[model samples]
Target chain A: MLLRLSWLLALLLAALPARGAELRLLPPGLAYCDELAARFSRLPGARQDAARGLAAEGGRLCEAGHARAGVARLRRALRAAQGAPRLARSAHP
Target chain B: MPHTRRRQQHPGPLWRLLSSAGFRFALLFAVVFLAAGLAFAGVLWWGTAGTLERQTDSAIRADAMALAERGRDSGLAVLAEAVEERLALDAEGLSIYLLLDPSGRRLAGNLAALPPPRSGDSSWYRLNVEHEDTGPGEARLLVLDLPDGSKLAVGREVSEKGRLRALLTEGLAWAAGAALFFALLGAWLMRRALERRLTPAATTAALIAGGDLSQRVPLSLHDDEFDRLGASMNAMLDRIAHLMDGVRGVSDAIAHDLRTPIARARNGLEEALLSEADDPATLRGAIERGIADLDNVTRVFQAVLRIAEVEAGARRAAFAPLDLSLLLADAAELYGASAEARGQTLNTLWPESLPLVGDRDLLLQVVANLLDNAVKFTAPHGTIVLSAWREADWVVVRVADEGPGLSAQDRTRVGERFFRADSARTTPGSGLGLSLVRAVVQLHGGALWFEDAGGPPGQPGLAVLFRLPVAA
Candidate 1:
């Protein structure tokens, strides 16, 4: 009986907690992220700023993935300004 | 000693007696302990093997996981880097890691091509890694499912763990050595303990063998089983020694005492021969003197024959179911003549049908010997009887006499061979008659009694009683 208890303890010790990022799943095309972004904005003030940055950067990321250079450049400009505000807030906070 | 030609070592009864209990116990202890040690050794080996196997598996997996972290690309590039890095760490490392697409195509590492992922656990496998001689004989590889429609293959083959093998070999040696040491130790202790207990018995036996009748095994304060056995042996030896002493004295007395009459008769014959015996009348008297000497010698030989026959167990073979009443009648009829010849009265009383299982001839002889002694020793007009009855499971026979009885001291020593009352010593008979009677009664799983019959101041001549079992 004591041997069995030691066996369980050894196995439990060996199963360490996973330490790196895993795949943050996304749906096909652009539907699920937009829905998530909309729900994100409806939260409180700090959440609203973070949500606007995600929406702008999410669009630019799609453009990059699709390889539309003109669309990507235009969105990058928009996203850069939005991204700068969150960075400033985060740095101050 | 070997398992063949056992007939070549056939020892006599002396060897068999020496090697009985001592040898048997020693052999039993050895065989059982050896088997137990072997079984324990096997269990120890199995337990160590399992521990070593599990440790090897985890060590190789840790090595692969650390290598996998450094690869810069997914699938194919990661596998190549993991394999290359592991080889650089240990030149002969037989570790193989493969990542494959769903279509069974090689995606990474040193694997030139991918084989299908196993359906279940497998035996030794071929991975696309290549190495020169002194390579692993066979590799242990497992296909593990990864989350992205790909799989991770991980394993390594080490010839053996050198340290574990060394420890196992050393452990087995120690275990065997301990078994041998303890077995010898235990056997020595057992032999010593056995010898200690047997010492008293051995000394007593040796004393008896050397014709010393006074030796006895002493008991100790512990009152243990060995003490009991020693005490019992002492009691038995006492009995046997007493019997042997009585036999020796009786024979010695018979030679010394009985020879007087023979010498007297022989001297009478010489005197007659030297005298002027010219007539046939004188010659006839000399012949009578020689006949008496011959009669005494014949009586001595007859007595020896009767006692020897009783002890020979010959009568025991003639045992059968018979009526005790019939035996009593025969004893009365057979001895009735002698009683009448001496002008004595003889009577018989018995149950109608007293059934008993015994040697009928011996039982009859026992009764006859008692009646004969009664009639011979009784005075004229004395009463004698042959009686039998059944009490419980035994048939009891009694021969009572109304003659001058044996004194208490004489009655006790009456059955010793050649023992005779001073008055009855003048009678013409061998003294072994009653001894033979007692032996026959004893051999039939029965009892005998020598009790006093009625007399004036002291008990009269003895009443000899005997009993035989009805059903054996």
Candidate 2:
């Protein structure tokens, strides 16, 4: 009886659409966020703590299925990274 | 050795077209039009694209100024909030903004990074932005340092504007290509038109060169430029043919007239040489007759040369203003004795002064020849009249004699070299007298003709009249 109930539950779970499959329909802002994040990562600077924090938050949001909010934050992080000097510099100098 | 004939090489159609005046004119016209088109395109590009760029720059400048004022008044926090709000409102995602703290930390906006600093913080910069949806784009940016040790960047993506400019440039290129095509077509058509108009003249000329003197350029009733040109060419051909006929007639007459005298002289001399008896009187008589015949040939040659000289305008340099009346009186006085000796009454009527410009010797010779003909042709006791008068712009002279007038056919042939009326064939004079008179009168810009002198029935005398321009 227990084995039959377990098989029935497994079949029900298989019949429902998967979350990963649903997430495959990419949001409009996801590509933009990825572009901004990639650009920020390539920037050469020392004092990028604020940008790093924002980028981390944006990545968590995107992974949590909040793509629009993630893109907004990633854009702000990119703007912050732009303020950094081209050469490395001390954060509190 | 057999001679090999070389074939003539004619230019090809392309070569002819390239060398034609019509094609050159068309090319020049096309070049001028292209230059004008280029100038017009340049102006259009400057007016449209340039104005759009200027407006974009102005908008960027004004936006940066407004943002700077806001940042100054409301502090960094408010400025950052305003930038975020503005970016959220930009549905096209063309707006670009960046704010930086003193420590180079991201505060707000959409730019991936600050562009490398140029000369100063206040200066404008052009940046390439990588947009996810639209590929790479150009942005006009103004980066400014706030009073609180922060920086702000304000810009707008201008990819659409760049695309528009590219489209305009492409259109201009296409327009230029089309213009070139039409210009070449026009040149080809113009060349063909010119060739069509000129072909008749060229063919006629070729036929004439091949010895067909009767060939003439065909004409159209349109009377356009080409028709006028054909008419002129035809007129020229007619004149050439007429002159050629005259030359042929002169050659035939010379042969006929010269052969008789020469044959006569030769026969007389040969007879004298062959005589067995040594008769001095007969030999002397033959020699004298031969000398007279030779002298007659010499006179004919001299007369021919004089006519040619007059026709060539060689004696025009000797022309002078003089009283034609006096010249006529002189001629009458000189010929009067000959006329009287011939048993013909000589009479003169003249104006005291008939002004004219002419070569004096030629005019005197003309008068003398006319009087000589009159005196020779008039019957015994007949009347000969010499008269001169000024009429209108002309000085008129007439020599009338009581002799049989010329037939209409003879009148037309009178001035031709070696031509003579059948009635005057027995008269003692070369037929060249009237020819010389005609040449002299023509050279002096005068007209000469003949008419009946109005005598009793069966005595209709001849009147030879000439008129010279008073100024000539």
* Candidate 2: residue B441 lDDT (0-100): 97
lDDT value, residue B469 of candidate 2: 93
Best by lDDT: 2
Q: How do the residues B171-271 of candidate 2 rate in per-residue lDDT, one tens digit apiece?
A: 98899788878877876787778778889988999999999989999997788899999999999989998898999998898898989899999999999
Residue B38 of model 2, lDDT score: 62
TM-score of each: 0.60, 0.73
For residue B436, model 2's alpha carbon misses the true position, in angstroms, by 1.6
Best by TM-score: 2
lDDT of 1 by residue, B1-472 (tens): 6587554454797676446676457555755675578667667765775566556566545544544443324554665544533322222233445566666676543333444444656522433223432232333444555545555565554335434656776887798788878876776677667778888888888987898868888777889988999888888987887878877887797887678778887887888888886888887888797788778877777777777787787767778889878777877887898899989999888879998788877777777788888987788988887777888888888888876677778878777788788878788677778888878887888877777776665536667888878887
lDDT of 1 by residue, A1-93 (tens): 336546754774474222221111111134323433343344343234444554466555554553222222322333333334342222111
